[model samples]
Target: MSSNKNKYCLFVVVIGFLTTNSAYAQNYKKLDSILKTANNEIYSNPDNVIKIGEKVVKQAENNVDYKIKGYKLISDGYSAKRNYEKSLEYLIKSSQLLNLSKDKLLKINIINKTGIQYHQLKVYDKAIQYLDQAEELIAEYPYKDSVHTELGKNYLVRGFIYKEKLSCAIAITYLDRGIVELMKVKDVANSSSKISIAVYNKGNCYLLMKNNKLALENFKKAATIAREINAKSLEAFALKGSAKVLFLEGNYKEALEALNKALSLSVGVNDLILNQEIYRGLAENYLALSQWSQFEIYQLKFLETQKLIKDTERTSVSESLGVKEAELKAKKIELSNKFYYLLLILILILILIVLFFYVLVKRKTNEIKIIKDKIYLLQNQKVKEL
Candidate 1:
């Protein structure tokens, strides 16, 4: 009877332990779900990101790795709004969290993100500082999934910055370097878009230098690759670039045809910046052909499109901020529900522990009673025999 009671007590303990652990697993699974959902909406819905990131940051109050990811997602949302100051603020927070990690890859990624943020703020020197740090780290590690794509992005941004400063020769070198690295990874999904951008920019540099032959060659190759990858924006830009080269070569008819196709594609994609560029190109083409009415129409359209794009950007930023606030309010209620569930689980675990001890103590007490009775019976039997 005692042995059977002990076995039952052990079984009860095991069951209670499993139930408590299951509660822990459920809580952790909630954290994982928040992370996954935030990642999915990071690009598509910044407002949703703010809510999800808030939860992750809350849940990761003790986990440095998760804290880093949550902060980074918030930073990306701000970056998408072009609120560079806010973006940099969150990125700095992420960097502080990342300092706890000894992982080389995490460190490299943080450096790269910092550099990209500085680049967006037009702080070229600071951008170079962080990018160079990442490059040095990569050199030390020198692994395959290394910084290949990131380094390509670094060079491309540097090339553009130099071009903005009118240091065309230096810009060409950097652009060419980026082109080489980017082309090597052109088949990679993430790398393909940047590859096209690098090639197009390189072609633009050659055009600026009056190397029409090489410019046209690069533009054609960029267009072909962009088309293959279904990168509509890059393809449109490439077409526009090729049109410019054709215009320079006195092929007005061919140039206009390419411009028309580029304009159509840009419009279909609602690429306002490209659409404005296309409008300007059409105006120039019409002016060259001595078509005054067409030039006037397109020149006005170009100005109007630029204004519309600016207005749209401002409106979108405002809307995202408002939506984020609402989401946070809703998230509070959701978190409250989760907290209650957690409280219930805790209560259940406490009750189980109490019951387990009660059963164990009761079994021990009964065993003691049985032992006492056996002693009494043995004493009586000995006295009667004597």
Candidate 2:
């Protein structure tokens, strides 16, 4: 019983910290500010994040909009801190706060964020659906740079999914399209961060398709771009991708140096995805050198990272399945509507035919009556003459 009480208390703490106290922005705008601060501190200091998150939550419990935003903020903070499960929880909560919004854009943002969470979970189908919805929403939006970035991400993610499935040709096509579209976007449409991600994906496509020289070139270009924008995390990612190419080509010595730098830069950022890549590179390099111990260590790390990735993917795919189901439902509705419209048109034509025949019959009846009256008058005139 005491254990149960403790569990309940913990749940309350989690819930309370993730909601706003008022429904309107007026009463709970402070929560947003507080959440923003908490999110900022989460990567730099998890303890401070929890502190500010708690403060924000305590202040905004009943505010639906604030609660929704708060949940998303907390999710981001947890994700930055590498607490994947916690992040997923808050993002899911944020997703359920639909009643708080009438703005299509905010809803879209939430969907996009949840889609990202699904991607992290490795649930590709769900990620695709959310991303697709986000794209549809973007098409209807007045204008925004973030939407373009989201679409670019959707394409890039799709490319990654295809690459993972070993459909290198399809992956490259999508990545190339994504790159072109992202470049053409203007006026807050360009996100250097988003651009770098797409370029990295493009390089992956090249590598997977066995265009090693092009892959090497794109990776180098992306790394330079990352450095220019102060994105150490992505710079490491580009290095890691390049090193993997070298490792596959039996260039263990060079791959080893590249992997070392990649790992060094990535670990500080808690970039699990990159960490996984570096480990795989190390495993291949160690195998090349015939170092059993180093090879085993790297293999273990890679396997662990792979399992985490697979889990993330599964979550994304589950969400995507729901989206697929929703899409199927919508299509069915459209077909039903079309059928009804066709039926109504046929009925309308039948009504017109019936009305036309009725009018013709009435006119003929009146003409017959006039003819009979004339005949009766002529007969009376003949009788008078007789």
Candidate 3:
């Protein structure tokens, strides 16, 4: 009867264990699905993305992978909203977990994203450092579709950096490589958006090179892809690029029309950067057409927008400094913990060494005593015999 009861209890425990594991698996799947949804809404509805990310962060609890992912999603959402400080804060949070994560791919992604954030902040050197780290990791990473996509993004950001530096020739090479890498990954999430961005950036580079024809062609292609992908902000930027090309070609009316279309799209997407660019384009077109009143109106709007951007940038810079301080504090604490851990290990080794030596000496001493006793016994026998 006792044996039967023991078997029954064992069966119940096994069933409970299986049930718990099954539920844990389901929970992770649900969280993954939620994160995917957040990713999809990152561009169009960034506020919604932030909310979903917060939910994921709370639900993930002590799961390192999921928490990092949640922080990344929040960072992306803030980036989309042009809140670089908040974005950097979340990215720093994700980076802090790198030591705790064994996922190489996750590490590469977080490093790459941190680089991109620096790029947005115009911290070119820091951006390059992070991108270089990501490149090293990618080189070590096994070949996979996702790796190709990440490599493409890395190249694309590098291209953007060069473009900002006015090295159009070098930028074009990197942008082309990025496009090729992205094309290698079929059906990858956000690949289309990334491709559009690469193409658009390429157009900007061409414009900088004074190659209006090539710039127009690239801009049109980028706009087509962006529209197909429903990436409204990218489409707006592409249109703005086209308008700039038209303006350079002395087609003021056509430029104005393109700028108007871009403004519509930008307003719909609520992209402040695009709005500022469009307003400036409108002002330029009106000035070229000798429409003084219209030019004045748009110029005022452009100035206001520029001021707003500057104000936001200033605030973001202040907040970013705070985040940096916090990160330094975290690093100091981690280093202190590591130092103490090393000290503990050294102390343990010293104790072990002392114990080992003591045992060896004691064993040798016992052997010597035994020899002395044996020698004394032999001498006593000799004396008795004598």
Which of the predicted structures, 2 or 3, would earn the higher lDDT when compared with the native? 3
Task: For residues 1-386, write the lDDT of model 1, one tens digit per residue.
Answer: 99999999999999999998897678678877776555444333556676677777888767787778778878866764455557767888989878788778778878888888767666677678888898888778757555677678778888888887767789888987887776666336556667777888889988999999989998888888777766666788898999999888878778889889887666445556778888888888888999999999999999998898778657545544554466688999999999999999999999999999999999999999999999999999999999
Regions more than 4 Å wrong, model 2: 1-66, 77-84, 144-146, 162-166, 180-190, 271-273, 290-386
lDDT of 2 by residue, 94-132 (tens): 778865678676687787777776676666777778878
Say which prediction, candidate 1 or candidate 2, comes out ahead on TM-score. 2
Query: Distance from true position, residue 311, model 2, in Å?
Result: 8.0
Instruction: Report the C-alpha lDDT of model 3 over 41-89, residue by residue, as the tens digit.
Output: 6666778888888988999988999999999999998998898988988
Ten contiguous residues with the weakest lDDT in model 3? 264-273
Alpha-carbon local distance difference test for all models: 0.78, 0.73, 0.89
Ranking by TM-score: 3, 2, 1
Q: Count the backbone clashes (under 3 Å) in each candidate.
A: 0, 22, 0
In terms of lDDT, the best-performing candidate is 3
